[model samples]
Target: MRYIHTIKPLGNRRLLAGSCMLILLPLFFLCFTQTARAGKDPNILFNGCQVLFQGEKPYIDQNNCTQVPADFAADYLGAVISQDTSQKTISITKGDTGIILWTEEKKALVNGREVSPDSGAVNRNGTVMVPLRLVCETLGSGVEWVAETKTIRVTLDNGYILPESTCLSIIAPPPGNPDKIGLSILLFLDRDLDKQYDDIHFIMTGIFDTIQADEIVKHIGQKKTPKDNLPYRKWVRDDRAVTAGSEPGDSSISIIIWETGG
Candidate 1:
């Protein structure tokens, strides 16, 4: 007579381990693929953009102007020319190309070769068109164009995230005394209400080192109150004191500290 035999299938721990391996194996392969493809795409960041003309005026007239600096003159481009006193949106044109703008420092792969852009400019029509090959190489954002979509997909470097477009405003400390406690204030327009710090405005207040006093005063102006009675050094409207930039729909203002001493 044949005897009936019973066999145990598998333990939960063994099954779990096998399942984990199954999930991890594909993830490993995916990571390898991404690394290999990383060589093809480069990541790029926008530091700053501006327009320059023969007269040396960066942005002239509210409307008509000559020569704009942006990321790309065609396709994808962002302009630095301040559209208004608030300096919210840099003039962006669609279908323009070859603009110049500054970018963060890093090596990127473009068309299989590495490249960098000390600065670049954009064109009219607001299309940020750059030397596709160069910008892609420097930013390490895989540069690929799809005719069907008429779009450029820039795959950023792994672990890289776009910075929140925010303004940096700094208020310097009082004159003389570098070691004194200072105040650095940041103000941003809460658009999303998420409180993630979308836009930034900085105001720094404290004692200033004697050597830096003159330069600080020159840029931001003298304190509204007396040197001894000054309530945090006041900010003046000087070319150097205030810097403006653009955001999607909002504006930004920055106040930088020049010195510590009065």
Candidate 2:
């Protein structure tokens, strides 16, 4: 089984229903961490999708909905979109071949018993498979696929990670230099909470004692926010050793100090 198809731009149900009434709507959890081998290559992470395969069967293409034998040779490493419409159609055919292939308006069960997707089938490489804990519990999110060293963990609910000692080491005032003593540079992080303002990096360093001895590194990269809010930029150094750079993983920095001349 191998699959890799890319398509972007499909999430704007009135801006996610007005940003789900001003945020705080995240409750989907799935944690899977196992690996050994012999069970075959299996490693998947959801809601931040990471599905690596072997003897594969993980379908989802209810007539172009996407994710089925699309030149399968997989490695998506990214995906997050819990409820954008919920038409429902999860699959993993073969050996414990789980099936919730509901198309007539959605409704398929497993532990509740109601199987009839051609019943009991297992065929790796020749297609026909299932299991990855039944397509992450039928796409609700919470599936761990580990086959003796193969790891797959799908945990979603607006997943987040903004802990670099809670970054924030700012010191602005450089657009025109009021006293030429405005140092410190920048380092910030607000990570998608839309408040109107955005700045990710710009620092060079002159050692304001390592900009007051560290504290500027953040994360929380994908929750999708764009109505206006994600601001945190305060870096203005006119020489003293400041050379910062970001946008390559490990981001979530916040440092804004604008209140001088007292």
lDDT of 1 by residue, 1-262 (tens): 1111111121211000001111111111111122222213222222111111221212211111112223232212211122221322222221111112322222222222223432233333433222343433232334443334322333323221232322222222222224331323222332221221222211111222333334433332322212212123344333113222223333221233333333
Candidate 2: where is the Cα deviation over 4 Å?
1-45, 48-50, 55-109, 118-121, 125-128, 131-134, 137-139, 142-262
Global Cα RMSD, each model: 24.8, 19.2
Q: TM-score each candidate.
A: 0.20, 0.20
What is the C-alpha lDDT profile of model 2 across 1-262, one tens digit per residue? Answer: 2221232232321111111111111121121223232333343443222433433434422221112221121112111222212543333221122333343332334433454332122333544333333343333334444455454444421122212121222222222233433333223233332321222222212223344323232232331323323343334333422223344333333233322433
lDDT of 2 at 186: 27
What is candidate 2's TM-score against the reference?
0.20
Prediction 1 global C-alpha lDDT: 0.25
Q: Where is model 1 more than 4 Å wrong at Cα? A: 1-130, 139-190, 193-262
